[model samples]
Target: MAEHANIPAGKGRSNAAILVACVAFVAGMVGMSFAAVPLYRMFCQVTGYNGTTQRVEQVSSVILDRTMRVTFDANVAPGLMWNFKPVEREVMPKIGETVKVHFTATNHSSEPKKGQAVFNVTPMEAAAYFNKIECFCFTDIELKPGETLDMPVVFFIDPEIVNTVETKDIGTITLSYTFYPQEETKPVAVLPAGKADGNQKL
Candidate 1:
């Protein structure tokens, strides 16, 4: 009689373990599926660092500086279907001098277009010395079909950059933008005391 009772109790324990294991697997899968959106977002934000890409609310400041033009040119990527061109291809910003860039972005698509842009200082060498004060890429721009906007970005080459050992050799920095339709659109809230609406400021 004792042995019979022990066998049934042991089987019951084995069944409980199997049920727990199955529940754990299902929970893990559910958790992972829900995490996909936030995970992809984290990857884009860190890699891109564009306020527009980050989808933060505020007037996106164009983050760039007029330091050097090292192989400078602008082009639209395949997906963006937009235009990115600088008013001036090559610019000279003296130490402590501030300059403005007129980046004309035109939406070529028939639907509302959006995108984020970034400027890279080549050689991956002078990144430490680069300093950018103001930019439009920090904000989001919404365009009606076939609309063109004159976006202004003001930046200055930091006086320290010229003094820095590594960046002094840099002669050019290229500023460019790429526009694409936003996925998982996050609204950038307008501040109450912020500059006028997008139209008013432009």
Candidate 2:
């Protein structure tokens, strides 16, 4: 009877170990899935896949005489209570010439709101050559109620764009930005005495 009992106890310990191993494997997979999102976005940005634009630190040194028409588009996602639009509809910029464009955003909600902008370039092939030096899309924006802000984006088209067979003939490139609400909230800004709204004194 004692020998039989020992065999069953050993089997139970082995079964428990197997269960733990399986649980660990599942947790690791879940972690990888979460990590994959940002990794995939980085990959697209680097390769210019899916119209994702590239980020650069400095302005282009070479400016081509040939100019290209670039258009702007702005959108607000469903959850964010903000009004967003490009200050300018379009501009003609010479290749490799740095240009700055502005977009305005106003928070219509009563409370402070945070949002992040995602951007992309149209004519898919042009994304690889459309580089951004400074962009508001890089970080989250926090705005107090009725606060309006002008956001700027500085970028230049790569001179190499004219050399590429796929992009050389492209006439116009459209840059679009969409704002979405952030999951985390930021601290609200305190208003001064007698100041009820962003404008107008009590």
Candidate 3:
């Protein structure tokens, strides 16, 4: 009876150890959940895994004969009372040539508004080949009541895009941005002003 009692005690200790391991694993996974978003964002930026493009300091000098149509898109999140649109419908630029475009944003609210833009490119694989030299999306934007500003983005299509089999056939890419009011700012809503309803898709 003593020996049998020792066997059960040993089994109890083994079960306790397994339970501790499982708890530790669950805790570790929960901790990772908090860090997942930013980590995944960094990974995508580095690898262009999803339509996230590259940011380069200097423009590429090597130009290619291939041309691509770059389109712009904009949207204001429900909580944000602002009008935003691309200045142009589309641009055709040869590979490796830099181009500049503007997006105008206006606050239609009676109170000051603060917002930030989140952007991505379409045709996910082509993201790795789109390089941005300068972009207003890098920082937060604030607008006084009824104030308007033209945001600019300077970019170039990488000439190397032609070398990659995955992106070689992609002759068009759309750069889209969506603006959301900062939660901390607590922006008030107001009726939209002129041309605010124009959400052009081209």
Q: Compared with the true structure, what per-residue lDDT tens digits does model 1 show for residues 92-189? A: 66544556667787887788876766555444444433444556566677666789888776655444555557666667655445544454456697
Q: Please write out the lDDT profile of model 2 over residues 1-202, one tens digit for every residue.
A: 4554356878999999999999999999999999999999999889788999999999998999999999999999998999999999999999999999999999999999999999899989999999999999999999999999999999999999999999999999999999999977455986676676657554
Model 2 CA deviation exceeding 4 Å by range:
1-21, 185-202
Better of 1 and 2 by lDDT: 2
Cα error, residue 96 of model 3, in Å, equals 0.4
Error of 2 at 10 (Å): 10
TM-score of each: 0.55, 0.82, 0.79
Off by over 4 Å in 1: 1-72, 184-202
Q: How many clashing pairs per prediction, in order?
A: 16, 0, 0
The residue-by-residue lDDT of candidate 3 on 81-176, one tens digit each, is 999999997999999999999999999999988899988999999998889988888888999999999999999998888888998888899999
Error of 3 at 139 (Å): 2.2
lDDT of 2: 0.94
Residue 118, candidate 3: C-alpha displacement in angstroms: 1.7
